[model samples]
Target: MGLTFSANLGFLWQELPLPDAIRAAHRAGFAAVECHWPYDVPAQQVAAALSGTGLRMLGLNTRRGGPGENGLSALPARGAEARAAVDEAIAYADAIDAGAIHVMAGFATGQEAEAAFIDTLRYACAATTRTILIEPLNSYDAPGYFLTTTAQAEGIIAKVAAPNLRLMFDCYHVQLMEGDVTHKLERLLPIIGHIQFASVPDRGAPDHGELNYPHIFAVAERLGWPLPLGAEYKPGGPTEPTLGWLLR
Candidate 1:
């Protein structure tokens, strides 16, 4: 099969709510769907939509507090809150049958951040059977973001040593922070739980990106990655019209 694309409802279908977006993705030919955060909508509602449409829920992020908060996993002072967030994420994942949870590491630095991250991972592993993912966000987009590179994520995953803890390789961020994506994908495939893509610099659809998604897709296919490359990009226009790239 070709590289299957999962619709990221967080960026797409801005006009519609979660249920409508889930249906829209099904109608748009996406086999799976992922979102930034779906905490507002009840998990049962999202699950019902997925169940009705037969579209799998790929992943979702833990609640990162509110407007000011990016993440809690790495915050040294928020250990209790971080564990609670993990529990909440697992609850939603259980309801939706989501494949994984992207455990966001908030803006942090120094040994405390690492210690908290390790603690959070250990807590998550014992808490749920679902995959626990950590992604490296580019500093340009998420300035001072605790996890900023594959190497840093790798080290945390190593120290945590949880069987379910895995990496979330976002191509857009990776390309910005470290350009050798194909090599990194090949090397990190074992630990990469999910793969997401958006245009480098613009964070738009893959067609307009500096990176050649087709070639990258081929590399992912060759490496035997799980299906559905997550399309975590903003549509320049409507969610549907911008999807012509998927047909190609």
Candidate 2:
């Protein structure tokens, strides 16, 4: 079966406006698009762009708490702020018809932080019907981030116990933090809400990565994973030139 791709506009076409980025993804043969944050752009314009391009907006991240704060949900002292961010993400997602919202867990640790995250997730899940995602960022790239492993994320999901709450499994991070990507994918398939990928180490296009995306994709296909796996990578230059990997 032909695999579908979702261009992550946050990394691709960074030079263009949000609306223009959506159009670019459509023109580039991406089945859909996802983003880091779209709050700066008006929801109406973003909605219109998605409507015009006929591309599904896959998922988006909640607002980072403040400067140096990667996320807010796990901050024990920032309960109000975390919930506010969740509300904002839900509103924006609803307007643009995004499929999921990735709740960022800021720099934190311990039982208190876990409790805070679970509480915040409960609020987020009840507030919207859209799927809620929590990603385990690599400790190397995201040092001190609350979540760092798939097992940790799975445990949190079990604790939160919200059907809408699932994991955002990014291949690059998983490969960096832990190896054996294919086996982990099969094991964690039940709780994975979204899948994203980039080249390992440098976070570049997947074509030249240490990991073989084609084989990984084949394993994913056999697992009956959903369509449009996310292409979230830094292009280094203009995104158009880096898209050769998409056709491979």
Candidate 3:
């Protein structure tokens, strides 16, 4: 079978109904669709949309609070609060039957923060049946974020030693932060549970970017990684027009 792909609805529009965006993704030829936070829409509504379009919910961000709000994985100092947050996210995941949750490691203020993130991740791994993916955001996009390196995320996953916990490998962020994407992907394939991409310079369609997506996809295929490749890019225009490269 061909690799399954998911379109991120967050990048699709700043203001649009989730169901409509998902239907549009189906029309654009995506097998699945993801969103940042689906809390805006009821879980039942999201489920209905998925059923209506016959599209799967790839994943959703567990970080709900504002920018300054240290996510569950980053606020280990406030252990109770972090656990509560993880519980809330797990409940939502159960409701929507999501396959994964992108776990953000909030601001990295100090060593204490790192410890907190580790603790939070361990808790989340134990609590959720769905995979918990640790994303390494580029410092340029998210300054002070704790888990910014694939290596660091790998180490954390190793320490936890939980099969359910894995890395959310974003090609654009890794290209910006690490550069050697193919090598990194090869090295981290075992630990990586999810993959997302955007064009390098402008965060637009993959074909227009500096990265070689065909080669990347080929490598992924060669590696025999049985995971969905997330098309989490900002479409330069309508989703269909932007996806011509992939369809070809």
Candidate 4:
């Protein structure tokens, strides 16, 4: 079977509005789409675009805590804000019929942060039936982010003990922080809710990167990954021209 891809509207088609981006993804032959933050756009407009284009809204993230905060759920002192962000994300995802909600863990550390994260995740899981995801960002890209490794995320998932909680395994971050991407995929397949990709080092389209995407995609197919892999890369210019990688 051929590999399918999801256009991360958060990066692609930056020139167009969110609704237009959904339409653009469909025209480009993407099977589905995901985004980082769609709260600014009206959910009705986004839903209308998804309905009109016949594409699925894969996932979205919660709000940041405040200035310089990448996320809120991991901050020990910001439990209320964290839960509020979770509530907002759940409501937005419901309006758009999104498949998952990635709860971002801001820059924090220690057992307190982990405890806060677990509590917030429990609240999020109890709040919605949709799958909840936690991604491990590379230190180089997101220094001090609470979640930084799959092992740590695995432990947290175990503590949360929610069936809907899963990992957002972004290949670029995982490869940069730790090698053996395919092996991790094989091992973590049970906990993986969504898979995302970008060129290593540069975070660009998959055509030019240290990691061989075709090989990785082939492995994903062999492993029986259920959904379209997410293409979360920077176009560096007009998104349309940068899409040669998708066609190739």
Better model by lDDT: candidate 1 vs candidate 3: 1
Pick out the ten consecutive residues of candidate 3 with the lowest summed lDDT. 63-72
Candidate 2 residue-wise lDDT at 86: 97
Please provide, for model 3 over 1-248, each residue's C-alpha lDDT reduced to its tens digit, 9 standing for 90 to 100.
85767889988753568888888878878888888878768888888889998888888887545656646567655677767767877788788788888776777666787788888888888887799988988888778777788888888888888889989999999999989999999988888888999999789988876899989988888889786688888876666668876686
Model 3 TM-score relative to the real fold: 0.93
- lDDT string, candidate 1, 68-175, tens digits: 889999999999999999999999899889999989889899999999989998999989989999999998989988999999999889999999999999999999
- The models' CA-based lDDT, in order, is 0.90, 0.94, 0.82, 0.94
Q: What is the C-alpha RMSD of each candidate to the true structure, in Å?
A: 1.0, 0.8, 1.7, 0.9
Q: Assess every candidate by TM-score.
A: 0.97, 0.98, 0.93, 0.98
Model 3: residues >4 Å from true position, as ranges?
none
Of 2 and 3, the candidate ranking higher by lDDT: 2
Candidate 2 on 50-145: residue-level lDDT in tens?
999999999999998778889999999999999999999999998999999999999999999999999999999999989999999998988999
State in Å the error of residue 91, model 3. Answer: 1.1
Error of 3 at 188 (Å): 1.1
**Candidate 4 lDDT by residue in tens digits, 1-248:** 57789999989997799999999999999999999889889999999999999999999999876788899999999999999999999999999899999999999999999999999999999999999999999999899999999999999999999999999999999999998998999999999999999999999999877899889998999998989899999999888888887888
Sort the predicted structures by TM-score, highest score first.
2, 4, 1, 3
Candidate 3: deviation at residue 13, Å? 4.1
The CA lDDT at 223 in model 1 is: 90
Candidate 4 clash pair list: none
